[model samples]
Target: MKKTYKIKVDCAACANKMEEACKKTEGVKDCNINFMMLKMKIEFEDGVDKDEVMKEVLKNCKKVENDCEIYI
Candidate 1:
């Protein structure tokens, strides 16, 4: 499944980092962050709980970009 959420990121580079972080997270098959739109699109793995997975995605994104925010 795929979903899009509002995101807060300071710059394009940080958005790239967030995208990479999200892609590396478990339960995520793919990810994209658009700095211009301040949004994140996530493609989740089959049968995974999106809410729980997004929690981890947000946590992982924070590791690389501490000030970034993803609205659950």
Candidate 2:
């Protein structure tokens, strides 16, 4: 399934990092972060729990951009 989320990121490069981090997360099939929009689009892997996956995505994103926020 696909989901869109509001995000807080400082810059384009950090948004790119968040996208990469989210894609690498286990339950995510793909992810895109638009810095200008401050939004994220996520394609989840089959049968993954959305809430769990999002939590992980947030954690992973925080690793690269500490102040980044993903509104669940």
lDDT against the true structure, per candidate, is 0.93, 0.93
Kindly report which residue pairs in candidate 1 clash with one another: none
Candidate 1 wrong stretches, greater than 4 Å: none
**CA deviation > 4 Å runs, candidate 2:** none
Q: In candidate 2, what are the lDDT values of residues 1-72, reduced to their tens digit?
A: 999999999999989988999999999999988899999999999999999999999999999989988888
TM-score of 1: 0.97
Ten residues in sequence with the least summed lDDT for candidate 2: 13-22
Note the clash tally of each candidate: 0, 0
* Model 2: residue 22 alpha-carbon error in angstroms: 0.5
